[model samples]
Target: MQRLFGFMCLVLIATAVPASAQERLKVVASFSILGDFVRNVGGDRVSVTTLVGPEGDAHVYSPTPADAKKIADAKLIFINGLGFEGWLPRLVQSSGSKATVVTATTYITPLKLGSHADPHAWQTVVNAKTYINNIRVALSAAAPADAEVFKSNAEAYRAKLDALEGEIGQFIGQIPSHRRKLITNHEAFGYFAKEYGFEFIAPVGVSTEAEPSARDIAAIITQIKKAKIPAIFLENLSDPRLIKRIAAETGAKVGGTLYSDSLTDEKGDAPTYIDMVRHNIRTLRTALEGVTMRG
Candidate 1:
């Protein structure tokens, strides 16, 4: 009778314990956006550490000794490849990590800017789905026992992405074709522009670290005037002075800030990948919908 009672107690305790009670896989994401993706797919099965925090620029990020420690301790390291993190190679070497490096943009057809493959592929909702798929596969491979959990989370997240894409299209549809053109802080929105049928002009190149020369700024100012671009918006990761100066020179309104390259913290507008896309499109629509394009 005591044995039966003990068996019943053991079963109850086992049933009461949550699935998340299992040991979590430690993973490191190169940046905040990738960190968010890992969290959504990984759920409670993984602990993610982002090397670059929210609103932090990855283009010019300098890896620290602490980051090296994080890498050494991780079972997997996720990054946005296409030369996004130039500092990652050295960091990995220094850390002597055996962690599997997963490139989130593995299946993406990259957009070229000059001689560089644009690294801001996450700007478009479609490519963001690809990222989620890649992360899901990687996570499943790392933790086969939790494959079903990862799969379910990824499918649900992809559905949300599809809905987000529809929402973006609806917002863009409301804007006039000619008025769809705008000037951004940098060349980070090529994928977004291509996917949604918008024209984005920028003074600087793909990498935020690249500064626009006088000639470059002058060229952008000329283009904005000639094309009658509606607004110039500031990017969260970029210096606002350049965009502000362009807006001042061309009489284009300074549209609200756009979250590019990095996301804002939890209290800010864009805390997650989906939130980032929604915030950008809404900001664009609000700025361009009422403006009339003159030839």
Candidate 2:
């Protein structure tokens, strides 16, 4: 096994083991990205159920009684925090789950959002490693019997993350610095912009649920015109009208769609978490490298 380092903590499973060998730690991850991280680090040691499944919109999701049952029975609950899952507290209470509720993004320095904390830390692979490690620690905490296993799994997964981060850096570097500015539908790419040294603008702010007022929209259009942002992009979970109107009003070409709130369809380019990151970098690079602002 690879050596383990520290900056953040890890949760090792030390509690009662399930009766069967196949028996695993019952874990409920608040959404797809966190759920995927838990799966990767937990490996066969845990059973993770995702509350927000593939292409599921977390911003507008309404949890049902069934989800409440899952949370109550889970050994641990993992949420992205940073106001990403505003609906979680009530669900946990309704479920009567005393299970440890851990923010998977707890280890990352979350970007100070416009009004709320940005929970999309997983966008940056470095921060993603934080989520991976925290999930390992959370699983370990809930089921301590698998402490060593969780550590081993976390170490291995983190190595993969290291490799992934390197690749993302190299891939992003391929795009000329001047061309790296991203204008997207929401503030979802803030961490990505920060980590990659790209300046990004969103007609909308952090939460997809918040609608931009006429003044806000006008200001965004004015900013777009002043900045000459070449391409305005659509996000997975937001309405297309705002981005489209901004692009039209600003005369910026529409960039391809970006995955902000959800993963791609199961059969599409970014179906899996790993693929999702790679696809995003690839998409951004292609669009940024090729696009030019009309004279």
**Candidate 2 lDDT:** 0.78
lDDT of 1 by residue, 245-288 (tens): 88789988778878888989989989999889888888888788
Backbone clash count for every predicted candidate, in the order shown: 0, 12
For model 1, what is the error of residue 240's alpha carbon versus the real structure, in angstroms, after optimal superposition?
9.7
Tens digit per residue, CA lDDT, model 2, 1-295: 2334332223233234443465788889998878878888888888889999888889889999999999999988999888899999999999999888898777577787777788788888888878887887778877888888889988988888888888788878778777677677667888888889888876543334566677777877787788877766745325678767877798776677677666666787677678788777777776776633221
Worst 10 residues of 2 by lDDT: 5-14
RMSD of 1: 4.4
Off by over 4 Å in 1: 1-16, 204-220, 234-251, 291-295
Q: C-alpha displacement of 107 in model 1, angstroms?
A: 1.3
Q: How much lDDT does each candidate structure score?
A: 0.87, 0.78
Candidate 1: lDDT over CA atoms? 0.87
